[model samples]
Target: MSDIPQERRVVTAIPGPKSQELQQRRVAAVAAGVGSTLPVFTARVDRGIIEDVDGNRLIDFGSGIAVTSVGASAEAVVRRASAQLQDFTHTCFMVTPYEGYVAVAEALAELTPGDHAKKSALFNSGAEAVENAVKIARAYTKRTAVVVFDHGYHGRTNLTMGMTAKNMPYKHGFGPFAPEVYRVPVAYGYRWPTGAENAGPEAAAQAIDTITKQVGAENVAAIVIEPVLGEGGFIEPAKGFLPEIVKFANDNGIVFVADEIQSGFCRTGQWFACEDEGIVPDLITTAKGIAGGLPLAAVTGRAEIMDAAHAGGLGGTYGGNPVACAGALGAIETMKELDLNAKAKEIEATMKARLTAMQEKFAVIGDIRGRGAMIAIELVKDPATKEPHPEAAAALAKACHAEGVLVLTCGTYGNVLRFLPPLVIGQDLLNEGLDVIENAFAAL
Candidate 1:
């Protein structure tokens, strides 16, 4: 359909002939420190499968870290982007505003959950969107401190890194982090506080109390959170936990900002993860899948809060690239046409059934969590003991890759396997990918 080829494989080994040669060249020319998730360099990809340079075909469960939700190489996306390219490429929006940029902002205002008069600002990446959100929050609330939770990942930028929780990889040697960025415990049910039964509002409340008591809520600009924690683990925060935090922020005049970079664009069954709880945040940061893989991110919020920033205070050199905006328009249309929200629920059904079955048989699977297609499996040394088994998780992922599936490992301890398949993936392909994972874990 539309030019995206149906599933087909032409190569043998994953890094077959051409890919290996290129890999050697890449090793010599490119940075060796950059890690490759899949050994094979991609020649082409569509829907759920990646065709390596060597012609080997592998099912893609990573979805480019949840960027291409509709699918890899979506036809409509390609066409719309190509059409826009023919007309014009870049004359930065700040230099010369265009309808495409305004159109995308309009779309975001309408799409993002809120009835209040909302405004939007575009950026080039998730990190940029996050940074801008923080800037706006500080300006709006006139406070210095920003509160983030444990296991939360905002981005890799300096300020975002400070807001991010993990240490080894994201923060390791990069900091000296930003000041006034506060860290609090998330409602992680699996590793609940001493006797806290199930991660609930009380767990979140405890964290809030500690933050307010230590940092003083009056000094806090925003309480930033990922409705469903992404890199930390695909752990959905406990029920009522988010609402409690949102209320606390409102009561204290703290800006409630939802970092929906990984959890937005129907990846979490709703248009946004925050929708599940009916929580209306003051500001929401979005990126990744917003433009069907192109680099575009945004901050959408109430008009007054966003306007608090001076006219020149917020913007980027390439904030709303024309091509990216076109791609976003196409992506938005594709999501609506395909009813991706419904597709997400279908994905959850498939994932829960498969993962639940695997958990029933494998004692290593300590937890099966997430919403919609944004699912993950937390591995353990012993299910009863609940000690994280990072090595086992790495081994299982390696096994799955060899068996023709591409998955990713995340979480603070690197013991969780996250699945972020394109929403357009065929059921058969999804099942086949899950089978690879099952076989990998079962064999272990």
Candidate 2:
């Protein structure tokens, strides 16, 4: 790994020469469906900075969408993964079992919520874990229907696409989605029909009623939701909502699956975001930050529920690649040794304070919501109307990029500016990134 400085510098235009060349090549070779966020290619990365091919150093505020909470080049991850590589790359855990895979499963069983006997199955992406969780739920309950909330993003796989709410970019034209998937209202405090205070109880009631009367909860296998809505604008569903849903699931024998892919692994100031609500999900899907930038994911839940699937029912060829497992163990070690959870809480405090102040100054900032390092601000055209201002978000992100700050925009309406700085990010760099964002709003 390159020893990148913890400074932001722009030596050339945002994309520069090499990135422009690569972008041109990517336009031809890469699939049209795959989109690039900034078109500026990264060459090297430090804790909180990404150095582009043009030698421009940019303050990283996205952390590859919360994947590198321990940093892209974290020392333990590099060391452990490299050692595993030298030993043997892959024998396929199915064909030849390995200790690393079992170790990772054990770590997940210990780390995830709930003390009850638990088991875990590993995969290569969040989508795969989610798909497997649904499979386990269906097998366990002998039911087919799977319920998901509005603005909930599970993954891009076929079944996951059916579970996801968004249409355009994700589900558009990819028709003939999987069947027996249902959608319900989320307790989005900002957009609930009633006030924020009523959102929790009301949305839960509406969801429970719909599941009971419309779909018949007995037919439902699982209810999947994000503790903090990720692609849907970082909407932290109103308080009391999750616990209510969990209760309903328990009452009806439906599996409650918390999709904590973006909010888990200490990104949300806790081991998992569900900890905030003190809700224990029957099954939990996790990825992104689990493996220190490695492609790994897992579906962990009650042992009986997880074991419902028949032997050789839930697995893939590269599900628990030895190197990725090593990376996960190291990542877990890094989290405990560094106390990244506390760091996440500290980051949340610093960021909420800064963003809240910005909200006061900027009328366009309609909401500032998120816990820990996974923070975001929603932009609206009018505070009263709350109309999405995607253009403003786009412009603001462009401004930050020009100033050598890497930021990202997301939301159902594309009006949310989310921040997921690495937990190990220096306070100075994070504050500097915030300073750039402040200037961008002023320029906007």
Candidate 3:
């Protein structure tokens, strides 16, 4: 035999033998409401790849839905977390504060955008960060109404659901959402109503005017938006739009909140997407990739604004879990040492080149957009009409999966394909994944 390491496929199908068995067992043992993104059962994972129980290896373009930026099972993250586990687990920061928690908070204060004095509070997920940001905004502005944009997704909690724009999956039947939450149109260039190409500045001004006129800015506490909308389709506000909105918020005394949950931590090539336009939010919420693979989110913002809440109003039992903090500390250090921000730029370059090529070759690709490593391709039935091709997206994902690559689809119409590959993904692996996508599109 050659010296190359053996590549094995013991079972017949993708899930093989053990995964299907586990699925049955899971169905019998757990609530049917619990869900999964893919059918494969994870056995182990490393940088840019996942291994199912049956030993099938797959490239991870989704990056746990943009969570593990350094890649899964990062060496530094695992090391720090393992060491912290040996020391102690949970003391509940509310009960007994720890150094790791403080370290992470200090890091955030220093790292997040803006030169203004700031503070940070940690939570378990992006949703919690969003909810807390709303609370702080309301308290600081002494107002009742919170303004969110169309295609925005905050969280599953009652208040966040009210603030979120999507309805079917997140807000449907979850009724009677919190009060004083209103929605406005996002600066979505892909589906501009007036058929204006690259209408960023005009869109922002129009949106601000309509919102202020309708809601009477005095009643609005905050205007929360994603620097680059994530689940809503990797939508980036057109140039000149973000700066205009920031000015409008400042003028109206509305807290300008950047929901950077999916766009922060160098995912968009900068520390935060807001930095791309030199826009500093009054409050910024981040999560998904902050702690490598661990669950830890944060609300980092202007000191005075963040301090609006009562001293005891802002924490959770596991708000700053020591283990997650340790992982975050490691994640931050790793980003600096490895220069992941620069790496993110490189990743973006590669994706843009390859995806641009794919766009030219495939008529289904209606638009190619995103900043840094967070890229997406919107699919359409016809370039002239710009009608979403949801079936084409589904078929493309299926074909790519069959050919040993994992891709994900997003967008309100379910026609955009997003790429959130780990910043640490090897160039060869990245190219391989793209090749699979190109082939799938060609077949279609």
lDDT of 1 by residue, 1-444 (tens): 233344534447665778888888988988866778876887678888887766677888889999999886776778888888999998888788889889998998999888999999999999999999999999998889999998999998999999999887778989898899988888888878553356777678788888879999889999999999999989888888999999999999999999999999999889999999999999999999999898999999999999999988999888988888988988889999999989988999999998999999999999999998899999999977789999988999888887778899999889999999999888888888888899898799
Ranking by TM-score: 2, 1, 3
Worst 10 residues of 2 by lDDT: 1-10
Residues 1-444 of candidate 3: C-alpha lDDT, one tens digit per residue: 011111222344766688889989988998976677567888777767777887777778899988889877788898899999999999999998999988998999999989999999999999999999998998999998988888888888999988877787778888998988888776788788765465687788777877878888899899999989888889887778889888989998999999999999989989999999899899999989899989999999999999999989999999989999999988888888888889889988988998888888888999999987799999999998999998998999888776657788888888989999888888888887888889899999
Quantify all predictions' global Cα lDDT against the true fold.
0.88, 0.93, 0.86
How badly does each model clash, as a count of residue pairs?
A: 1, 0, 0
TM-score of the candidate numbered 2? 0.99
Clashing pairs in 3: none
Which of 1 and 2 is ahead in TM-score?
2
Query: What CA root-mean-square deviation does each model show from the true structure?
Result: 1.5, 0.8, 2.7
For residue 158, model 1's alpha carbon misses the true position, in angstroms, by 0.7
Residue 238 lDDT, candidate 2, scale 0-100: 98
Q: If both were scored by TM-score, which would come out higher, candidate 1 or candidate 3? A: 1
- What residue runs in model 1 are displaced by over 4 Å at the alpha carbon? 1-11, 194-197
| Candidate 2 lDDT over residue span 1-444, tens digit each | 557889989999999999999999999999998987889898999899999999999999999999999999999999999999999989999899999999999999999998999999999999999999999999999999999999999999999999989897999999899999999988999978679999999999999999899999889999999999999989999999999999999999999999999999999989999999898999999999999999999999999999999999989999989999999999999999999999998998898898888999999999999999999999999999999999999999999989998888889999999999999999999899999999999888
Q: Model 2, residue 68: displacement in angstroms? A: 0.6
Give the clash total for candidate 2. Answer: 0
